[model samples]
Target: MMMNHCGLLTERKEAVPLKSIEVQLEVKDHVATVVSTLNYENKEDKPIEAVFVFPLPGDAAVCHFSAQIGQKHIVAEVKDKQQAKEEYDHALSSGQQAFLLEGSEEISDIFSLKVGSLPPGESASIGLEYVTELAVQADDGLRFCLPAVLNPRYQPQGSESPSVQVTSVPASLVPYSLSFSVQVSSPHAISKVESSCSLEPLQYLNTDQTQATVKLAAGHKFDRDIELLIYYKDAHQPTAVVEAGQASAKPGSLMGDPVVMVSLYPEFPQSVMSSHTSCGEFVFLIDRSGSMGCRMNQKRPQETRISSARDTLLLLLKSLPMGCYFNIYSFGSTFEHIFPKSMEYNEMTMEEALRKVEKMKDDLGGTDILQPLQHIYSQPCIPSHPRQLFVFTDGEVGNTKEVIDLVKKNSGSHRCFSFGIGEGASSALINGIAKEGGGHAQFITGTDRMQPKVMQSLKFALQPSVEDISVSWDLPKGVSATILSPPITTLFQGQRSLIYAQLTGKSSETTEGSVTVKFSFEGHPSKNQLHFSLKPAEDSGLTVHRLAARTVICSLELEWKPNGQQNEEIKKKVVELSVQSGVSSFFTAFIAINKDSPESVQGPLRCRIIPTPLYRAYIDSQVRQCSGKIYCPPSGPLIVL
Candidate 1:
């Protein structure tokens, strides 16, 4: 038997062990801290081992994991991934209670948790906490998402699959319940908070409107991801936050030193913005995999992903400047191109492409984007015409790292604009390729109009590029700065650019510092500066420090080479940093063991897979329903965690 929910796959037909979940979210300005408590009970007659796989934001830093049974509580410790696995296995084999949580090696957003040796009739409460920076949307609203829908990733031939087999069932059949609430505070007055899921009225906690609280409306089925768009009074204003270091950590370390996070929204001159460039090459890549035939959302069952992509392509084709060059490519197991080379944009070529795009269907077998990308990069560039690549997909590819690395390798030749089509699209893949290629990434989900967002990116592509970007800091006499984030290579008008820096040495609380960002736009030089106080914010948690650490860790992970020596060194550094900062990484995991129980349980253990909810479209046609349960014949060997 096969069962699935939230990317979790189980091999047994027994009832799920998970019962309910409660979440608390606290937002301070642009960063958010989330804590989730999951309640589980083993009702079977024998001891069982339960495993669960789930999704999280790609950029989040998991800082805490703990478990409580009755009056006893156990806090997990971050350790090397291999070491943690060994310890967990030993505890399970010895009939002791243990818990382990680890991130996927291939995919950063997916994680697996194991509950070992849970005696029958026993109950446990698991706590998970993470911190992440919210992304700013085109309309200046900060976006916060709790990922609940994860579709199965399509692994290409000759690629090794991750330990978990991700599958899905209809959302209506999910047995678990969820409750969520949020407390938001910012320096600027809260304009409003909106969500794709139903939300209660926003209540102001203070007269100034700087503090507010909100909750998710009742009867929210886990059919789609929970997305919250938060708007502040002054959304585009440049701001800086300084957070103090951890007292228990060693000085001069990432966690021990104060970190400053600066948010910049660059403004271009009106003269340059008024004129859109007419001489550039635009390339569009569309995903035509079998899954593209699925409905975009449960709300709109008639509009499939392929149909939406087709409509968006029409808008893009119609909006292009007449003097520019463009082409279209669609891929699945195989790839095809509309033109042998990029053709000049004109009436004849535009109409020809439109006719072919309208005939496009989801006939492709699987999502294999690397081949078309490689072929695109192999072509020669058109002189005097910069290249901008627009990618449209549902983002179910498995080899995310390889695809992102390929884009980065050829980043100098072109800019990439990526769009994720549906709820379960891979954020890591969509954001990584765009970030590495120095362009923008957008997600279209839940009643969103694809044309507006695609056209916004088209406008960005038409805008003149920003060049000669540099960041400089003016600090107190004794203090020096070590930049943690990669240098800023791409900047768009009115887009947010985040910089993280570690402040070393000492300075008086009364001192002040300033940062200036200088860049060239359309052959004209311009700069923006923001002055901030040296004193760290009172009651500010280690959110900034953790975020900075995650930024650094991501950069280091990208630097990994296939050769042994460099890869080993990079792994060592990541493990050390991950352990020191208490942040989960690809090289490390969180493990907890209950030592209070003096005696081993006298029984053999059975393994139970905890079911999770997913969108109905995620399942393949081979799935059959019988007696209100979903089942599928094994496609391949089930790789248990």
Candidate 2:
């Protein structure tokens, strides 16, 4: 049974400790720094501990966490995950207040925060800051999302463990309030800032129109995620930013060397772009889990995710080149294939697939995508016809890292194009597989027509694959460069590729440096170059350095193995880098202890779980009536107190 007050799921209804959240965003070109402050007050008579699970963008680097308890201030320190957990447990056993924030072991985007030993009527404020690179949309705008919903991830039976335990209620019933504001600055004029939610009018801060401020409209209900599309006048122009190293860090280290972030927008020649390859293999993987029966968004309650996916699949099937090979696969607790093997695209095959797709239902019990993926990858790829795999899902899978690793292992034979079908989809799953599989990722949400985005990706698939990509650097004598990010493997027309590099040694402030990217597309070689000053931008706050560190850490993590001597060394390096850079990783956590408490309270600490808002569609579809009351099904129960 759901409680009326904020729809909390508890044996005994009580006031939620979380009261309000305030967010501040600073955008410099395509990178953003977000600082969120959460205010909490213990209204219970005895001491209590609260646990909250939340979502963050998969690529973000959390750099700061602090807490203010009454008049005492404590700043968290990044430490080894086990050590941090031990410290937090010890503090709690000693009757001292403590806080522990950790990233999910299985999923990168899911995080859990524990606020322990809050005294009765005492108030605390938490501050969390992170920096991330904004993803470029199919259009020229940059996209930034603040995820407020944590949908339950479906765990297959016999899996190791669930990523995170999420307690969710309807969006309209969330208790806390949110205040969000953004300040944007760029090299070019800010054309506009659009959001899926309501927002106040944009306010330009400077006469040049390069600086602006905007805020969310008052009284916004915490429902779907907040998405902002920021547009600039010259969005396609290539640029680079060099950030100085931290002065306190030791030299010759990652944090000590100056880092440069280069943004490249590759433009294919009209002749090459106009021609599309007619010979290739296209495989479409669709999700038919029970949650797919839910509506796509609040505005279109009649349009369910399966329906939209079906319509998009129809368009994709009709658009295939005549000579291409194709197949269709759908997965849930089990999987089905339209054809036993890849077949030539023709009228008969197309019609058969269309008829079967129309009759598909969302009766599958849970999301178990690994088996289907293994089956697809096991098939021998047809020679002379490149394979392109298209995966469409609401992104509810629990084995994200394993799936992404499998894709990376099989990437040589196929390129994967991924589509996230609805709100609260796992960005880590969608983006990770696409990035590892050497293709593109797209998110469809909030009245978005899946046709356009899917069609765009198909166009990318049909384009001639780029090859022989290489990067070169030009710098003054005695100055060298070290590449930090993984090498660029795929390039599309008008798509942006970001490169991060470290500059070692020193050069004059007036010295200049340049980088050139060369690649072969459609049998034609092309190059793009950007030149910039050696001097770092003043007061840049080292955003580039942190982002570069995250890039290197992710690459290192992917190289790690479960039971290898080399993997242990790799894990140690990741921990050291994460600690030195103050960035969150799979092996480290942020821990804070309140040492200056006035007194130790003598009482048993009650445990409370702050429920995040569930998607309205899930509430409608998953809840079942039983014996005059409504309850969620046992197959995938998301409501837990």
Clashes of each: 4, 0
Candidate 1 residue-wise lDDT, 1-641, digit = tens: 12333324333445567778888999999999999888888888888887766777778899999999878899999999999999999998887899998988778877778888888888998899999989888777888888766656777776675424534445566556889999999999999999988999999999999999999999987766788999999888999999999999899998999999999999988877776466799999999888788777667778888888888888889999898999999998899999999999999999999999999998777788999999999999999889999999988877888889999999898899998877768888999999999999888874464656777788788876789999999998889889999989899888899999999999665479999999999898999999998889999888899999999999998888556568988999999999999999989999999988657866888776555544443334332210011111111011234
- lDDT accuracy of residue 326 in candidate 1: 95
Q: What C-alpha lDDT does candidate 1 achieve relative to the native structure?
A: 0.82
lDDT of 2 at 632: 19
Tens digit per residue, CA lDDT, model 2, 102-122: 888788887777889999999
User: Candidate 1's error at 124, in angstroms?
Assistant: 0.6
Model 2 poorest 10 in a row by lDDT: 625-634
Every model's TM-score: 0.94, 0.93
Quantify all predictions' global Cα lDDT against the true fold.
Answer: 0.82, 0.82
Cα miss at 52, model 2 (Å)?
A: 1.0
Q: Candidate 1's error at 196, in angstroms?
A: 1.1
